[model samples]
Target: MRLFGTPTSLKRMVPRGLLGRSLLILVVPLVVLQVVTSVVFYERHWDTVMRRLASGLAGDIAATLSLLHRYPDPDGQAWVTDFAQEHFELQLDFKAGEVLPNDEHFRDALSEELNDSQNENMEDVLAQSLSERLHRPVMVDMAIFARDIDIYVQRSDGILHITAPRKRLFSSTTYIFVLWMAGTAMLLFGIATIFMSNQVRSIRRLAVSADGFGKGRDLPPIKVEGAREVRQAAQAFNLMRERIQRQVAQRTEMLAGVSHDLRTPLTRMKLQLAMMGDSPDACDLSEDVAEMERMVEGYLAFARGEGTESASDVDLVEVLETVVARFQRDERCAVELIGLYTASGERRQAPTTVRRDSIERCLSNLIGNACRYGQRVRVHYIAQEDEESCSIVVEDNGPGIPPVLREDVFRPFFRADSSRNSQTGGTGLGLTIARDAARVHGGDILLDDSQEMGGLRVTLHLPL
Candidate 1:
């Protein structure tokens, strides 16, 4: 079940791997936190600080205006400027019989880099505070200076212009706050990346080991690391591997011992039959001994086919060609080779890594069964490189097994030929051994009715 986005398209937009999803989980929340913090500061803290500073600056301007109005003489204006500079730390310039033009011009091109909604909000608060304090319309430009602010206040006869540092209405603490927040978030994300990469690396190694084991290949040892659960899973997989190997070994040994033990009595019986060779009873006993030997050999072969061989790169087309060439040598039945295919329905020239001996044994068994039962057999091979899957299909124009007994054909010693005819020469174990071989390579063989041949169609599917 998916717990993230509801829609399938939305889920597709999400990353498929653990590390990508984990990074998304980390970064999205950090981005939201940063955005929320910025909004709160602009809405509450930034506006409050700007309003207080503007009010203080407004009082300073009012005092300067009062001094300028009280002393209208030139000498008095000069004295007022000196007093204001000493008290307010503002550079004030006064001109009589002159006025700052009421142009009311404003620079509207805000810096896209530094200007945002919060910056505009602070500008509005400062403008409102100064307009109330001065009791007249005033134009204040903040962007004209990076470290200072300019104030234009009109006097009765002229204009009073003051240039003050930006500290009067803006806060430097804002820069420090944002810088620290970004630095902290980056450090956290860096740590998360390192941790997630380590965790994912462990999982990747585990997957490689599991895949190798499935393909009947020898895998390098897996070192348990990462989270506790991952380590536990690795340990469990290792334990399961040990149990499977032990079971295979036990079965192989038991089958070998049983076959050896039974062969001794059979060898004695064959010797006894040789003594009475001329009689019909001796000939019938010899036939029984031969059939018993065949059954024993079939059982042992089936028991030993748990893929003791390692997987290797083999050209599937070459493998099919070799199998077809072998069957072509036999004159009893006509074996035809259909085309080999890839997932794109194109001919493939690349080698597929697989258990060559096991796959060959599987193909030979299936084809052998097909030719043994049918007068004509066909082999078709398909490899889907992109999907990492391959299939070998064998069909025959023989009398197909009844549909009800199709699945039962794979059971040991359960032959469709219940009469056990010498012509068939089967111990009812060929398909079982073929299936075992296919499964050892992480593949399977299935039986179905052939629509074209009106007979049996066997498909072998393997994942690369």
Candidate 2:
């Protein structure tokens, strides 16, 4: 239900988490792409790089041993060891038995003791353990044929036949590639955030401007920006607003002219009727003139209030109470005040204030119309359960309005078959005036078949 020409609903389709939603849409895909690409590259290429580096180190160690064998020279072996250490921190360990030489210094320190017969048995035990653990042949620190020479790589794991180096022979270009991919992803994410923000901001501006226009303010024309669709929508809204404003202005002018023209004849008729001398028909003439004047005035009032008015904050509950009170006073009808309501889980009162005077008049008209048409009128003032609005229901137990006439009852100069020619006279403008007032407040009046009373029920709803 509405006050006069108001929409009963105020809802928007856009979700509250629009920005977060957009960011998620953008960010999730980028992250997934990076993860997938990195995994695939690591498996297909990175493992191969590690294996090649291991093989190259093995080959380098083999060549060094061969060179030492050819020269039987400590200087050459030392030179090769120094070169390997400088490049990849390779430590040359000669595994004799379980007791491997720790380094060159340890080898020299224990040489004499190592040559004893008892030490030879200890060496045999070490060599047996080293041969089994290394899973391959190993060289001992002795003349190539004099002692089993085992050059085992020294590492966290006791000794391995294969050499371990500090760094792998992986391409520097691969690191650069990964960094570039990360940089590109971040850049895209930033660009997407910017674009989405701009789009949403444009929509926000459009919404604000529309709100201004709805309030009857002359909002500055919106500048189209952002995505093409959004810009187009803004342009369309501007054009539509202009068109609506022009139509409203034209309608106002037409109503003003028509009302003026109608009143001229009514005025003329009243003046002529007043000029008549005192007679039996004079009373009838005055009544007819009065009714006509009332109708014309009502039409003008309804049109003016509904079209030109702007809404303001109105305490809808208070407005209903006031209107119902006035109705009770004027017609001496009993009105019931139902419970006050709070909306959205808040204890605070919900007040819907808009065009106050217009809404009051509309309520009065509806209630008064009911009183005239029905006996035992029950006027109820209750806030709507829905958080969006409040309601006023005026119900009566009379011979209800016919279904055929219900739709047309709100038009100006329209009266039901049970009303227009009745002994109880009316100007046939009550419902029209009420509906107009409803529209002005951004609400509406609805006629329903009263289930409890088995008569007419008129409901008025105004938004909070």
Candidate 3:
């Protein structure tokens, strides 16, 4: 997520791409469940609240009607008027057959109920509740029934009345239902997007960092957080990376020490050999000592990873050309450079730049091996079918090596038949060093049958 600095953060969110896939498995179903739950919960809650509100409203209306009927005196009327004024709007119109005695107190009570509340119709809520209770459509509007009681509304100077024998009150269910639904949905969505994205992102970071570590890149140590399981995974990955790095460092140091110590004996041997002189066999002994020196130097250089860190941009074409030229100078070996060009048909193009000296050494080892074991050798530098890398192929015309021995050829100090044959020089470290160099450059060399040349084919590939 850090955008401006190193590529450390810009690496893909998951190492194997499965972390994002796993998150999708977890989150997609959860989101769907939440949505379904929200809808079902809202509807169920609305029904329960609406039913309760309807019962309360019906009871209140019946109780108010009873209080009005029983208390027909002025004090009673005054109390009724006070109740209506505080709670709702109502009207009382005495029928001729059921007349109330005309009194100032009763008149004041009637007047109070008339002037109490703002006159907006509650017909819609009442009708909806009625419809739900009856399980059939019901319409309520401003109207008066029997003249004894007038339940009506007046707005904008227009009197609207509702007079039903069975009174109804407005249900409060709609307010509660809407509020609950809106709140639940907002909460669910917020938790799903923000909280889940963060959890999934942390997991993705851990996976990607593990991948980068495997590929020999330094990933920032994972800082574990979030849910318990995710944190555990991150912590485990960090520990594994540290362990592997330490082991690799130890191995590299051990190799460095071994290479350094070998040089001291080699130096001493050189001095001892230089002193041998004035004999008929001295010339042959000196040549043998010189060969021993070359072998020792090669072993030391190969063991040290060529005295360089695993980095450097090598011009691959120059490496191939230089190796071929070196063998060309050795007229005893017939080395031919085949069509070694980029896929783009650019004659002077090199497909990759890697550790220069290491790549050159790898090429030289392959060509030298071919010359020693086969009659003719040809080297090719070109792109492969995948179009993402370059391959170097060294093939020859002699009888090919057995398939079983091909794999063994890359082992350090592994010679095919016996101790340094006439076909191969001293110290069987050539293929091992070559393979290691290719690996350090994020490439590899593979041995196969040379179908065209009827011998061994060694292909070295490096990433673009």
Candidate 4:
């Protein structure tokens, strides 16, 4: 059942990192247990102890009063005072003419502010106990002196002022109990933090290794040094990496052999067609052979996405400028770079680790396709520092693919242009190859309508 806030709001309040959440799990219960223990101790054990201490002090005072009443003469009263002070450790003083002050006056003259609720409770308990025993108005102030409690009792003659040691009513065990609880809690929390950090370190290493691997960066196997579950995950990741590498190696080797074999026949056909040039049938046959060769090349490029290229730290803006420059040389279409500068008008650089060849090829395909379909193409580079990513958007003012076919156009040999015209499109593998290159580096290509250009917009997003 939902309680305080909506589920979404509660989720936002929760810690996003595993370590923070784990520590919270440990701390919350420890805090709750300590709170409950303190409440129970104060409610039952501590309260009972305070009451007993107050009652004992009140009994001593009542007994002293009784002795004073018995010996009303001056010499007798002085002896009783000496006896009470020696036996009960109380300093007694008598005022024959002075009457007990009113509540407000007494509070102003004798009471001092207490530091905590415990002292206030102690004062209340002692005052209630004295009033019950002496059958007279009484005022108790613990804060009047550092080590003494000032208690005033109203009598018919005057007032009996008693000075008792603060230790008689205040328990030292309360502070000891609280300090012990806090010290132990802090000790346990520190221990848990150390152990939790060790466990989280292993998980963090695994996550970083996995992210690098996905981005096509080679990394050594991670050390499995955490709990059983974390160790198992690291083991699984290592095994998966080995299996995928083996499969890719096998596929590349097989395709290499096929490419070599197919090129020989195509080369012979091209030479044969050159010898029989100018004949209509030979020219038609040469065109067919060339089409076959184009299709074969497209298939190989698609299968060998990134091939064996190593990733390196490259400036993405430099790569985009190179591609744009190449397209600019072509008079068939006009291309422009929109975002090569920061908002402050200084030149910007996007430095990230990526396969340079793969990214270049991907950009070539996307821009080449746009230039082919439209007269003007605009390339926008958006660096999203907060997201730890960047995007290269290629927009063209061409008749964009319909919403339904945008996804289908990414399939190999599936062209939006149904005419199968070689002048318009080649083997329908351009988008497929571009997407594969992007995905090889743990990025993706997305197609949407361009708000500015009113045509197709292709955004290639890559992690920095």
Candidate 5:
């Protein structure tokens, strides 16, 4: 029910980048101005100039014919020709006792289609003026001469032929005007492109810096450049990044203090329990102390996962193999290490820049959970080089998480009834910590049902 398909479709047709749209904004008006100027010049200035030049030439030829009629003698005719030639720059020739040809014969013999619209218009104007003044047949042949025009005028006794310089009827200013207009437009457009690109470059650098920071990659402060608004934005971004970093540092310090304060009492209680006799109550209290220690460890690990670890180029395959081998050594669960493969079925190593410790911890948490819940664990590495990303799929052959509760399990300290039960003995922060680490590297962890393994499929996707 819309003339255009939709607003979204129209938006797709427009340039998505700022540089391209800015150039478009600059070019559209310039082209419209040029077109309007050219049209005005052609319709008013060009037409008026050609008409006046043709009329002037026609008046001179008319005067020559009148002088010839009055004298009639060859001596007087030669004199009139000399006078007209000296004054009007028209070369005249008179053929006595020769009849002018009919319109059909004249067109067949001398008429030609002129390529230039200006020349054609000039020919029409000159031919009209000559016919009106002489009241006789006039044939204008513009193509007969390269630098001159041949005009045939019917006289009382014969046909009069007049050859006039083509420059007299044509103005060179039109070409000069068009050339200057086009050249000026091109030069201005080039200058605009250069200036716009420089402005856009500042914005581009700001964007890259922001993205790197978001991905947990360390980058220097963005240099404020370009227009006032862009520089303001860059300054604001730098301030925001500093504020976030300060807040994170403060949080980490507070957590460190809290861990020390809690662990001291827990350690003292453990010492007391060990010193006491092996009573059931003492054993329960010890187990409770151990669980508290694990909860504290989990909290500290979550905080440390987002620590100030600079990114470096590391082989993802090697890290994945190492984690799989460590789990394989446990021998409690079946761990299968699948080599990295591209979509083309070729094995290749994935080398990407990421925080090595964060990525290793994320992988360890995922594998450890799989081993705890499932009997068989399969780690499949898929490298998508073209997309600049790689995916590590950790699948298990245990009672898979229900699709409805899959997302809930990722919440901190949240557990599902079926698989993430208390008997499994988890602090319920494993998936939360793993996902946080993945996101810090500009990646994500997705949970779904494993079709092949008939259990949970945890895919950790990271950008290269």
Candidate 6:
């Protein structure tokens, strides 16, 4: 249910990406299982094997020393060394005047990176194994040599120095075990990634279709495929879309019926007024009928909406220019474009998809309202660096709408007073239509005081 993240602490620790989070989901337990198995291996398998081997070696050394001590002659020492080498596979030597040192060196049999921790733990394991069996203190040096370790023990006469391969202490098979575990984790992660990617793709497609629907654009039907939950969601989306289509069709039909019924009566009223033309009473009635007709048309326009137009890429720069040009021909107040040109050069045009005529109508309504109420109008485009959206602001210098009534002005046929109404000559549907059009494109129209114009500024924002 949480989109951006889960619980706050986990949200921060985990990566903010789909694949990264999925891998973390897979890898955390894999690492846990590997750690558990490794601990078991060291405690049960590795320790048991090393202890048995070290015990045998320690017994052989004790026996050989006993034989040499019992004889004590040069010939007896020579015969003990030769016989031990041939029979017990022991490489033993005596240093007549030397003694075993107090200090001992430690290192891992395998990796150097693990030396610090492995060296201490392994040295303890080896020393304990030797002492428990042989009942003698042994100096274990695993670091001084590359592939072998030196064992030194002092007797009353001299030091017995023995060299042994480090493999006797630890098996190489552990490395193979680690490699296999790592390979299996990666394979699981890869399989999870493939499935997750497919599921994510389906969700993204559903989101795109929903966005397009909100923006009043018709998109192809989305395919329902993925897990059971995703398929159910897609099915619900299809049903909702169908319901909306049916409602739109019914509304369109009703509007057509209403237009036909109302216009037939108006046509007759107009014809009757024309036959009684020129008389003062008749002229007044004609004016009233014309005003009524205008009101009816405004209502119909607002009801009809932007019509069956599809969205397309529109150049807002050109739209603003054309609207200004049309106002100029009508001899309205001079309107200038700001931010469209800069001292460095012409600004880059930001492209956005919109219903062309819908935006045009919205702009024209705002511009006309501005020109009627104000002497000067300033239009500008604002495109921020991130480029998520663009803004078209039309500012005019005139008596601005009161802050309280600004919102009220957008209501259908809600004129503030006679002075404002007579001057603008509107049914008060202009702002309503403009705002509705903007909203359909996932944009909005906002009215505020223009700092430069000291009047109303109507800003229209459309997504890019």
Clashing pairs in 5: none
Tens-digit per-residue lDDT, 22-128, candidate 3? 55555567668767865676456544554455555534444555676689687996797668545754443333332233433222222222221223224333443
- Residue-level lDDT of model 6, residues 11-63, one tens digit each, is 68888866577778777888899899998887677767766676666677678
Q: Rank the candidates by lDDT, best first.
A: 4, 5, 6, 1, 2, 3
Task: Name the candidate that leads on lDDT.
Answer: 4
**lDDT by residue for model 2 over 290-315, one digit each (tens)?**
87787678767766655566656766
Clashing pairs in 1: none
For candidate 5, lDDT tens digit of each residue in 272-390? 99999799999999999999999899988877667568888888888888888899999789999885655588767778888888888999999999888899999988867485888
lDDT tens readout by residue for model 1, 1-464? 65665788688988999999999999999999999998888788877777788788878877887887789788998898888778887788655566555453532222112233554654555556666666765556667547767666665666566877777776788888889999999999999999999999999889888877877777756888889999998998888878877787787778778888989999999999999867988898899999899888888787777546677888878887888899999999999887665457877553677878777777888999889878999988775657577788999988777777777878887865532222486788888888887777778988898999877899998775
TM-scores for all candidates: the values are: 0.78, 0.64, 0.54, 0.90, 0.82, 0.80
Better of 3 and 4 by TM-score: 4
Model 5 earns a TM-score of: 0.82
Q: Name the runs in model 3 displaced over 4 angstroms.
A: 1-19, 34-278, 314-318, 338-344, 347-354, 382-388, 418-422
True-structure lDDT of candidate 6: 0.78
Each prediction's whole-model lDDT (CA):
0.78, 0.65, 0.63, 0.86, 0.86, 0.78
- Cα lDDT of candidate 5 equals 0.86
The most accurate candidate by TM-score is 4
Candidate 6 regions exceeding 4 Å error are 1-94, 104-120, 260-279, 328-330, 341-346, 405-407, 418-423
Residue 351 displacement (Å), model 4:
1.9
Order by TM-score, highest first: 4, 5, 6, 1, 2, 3
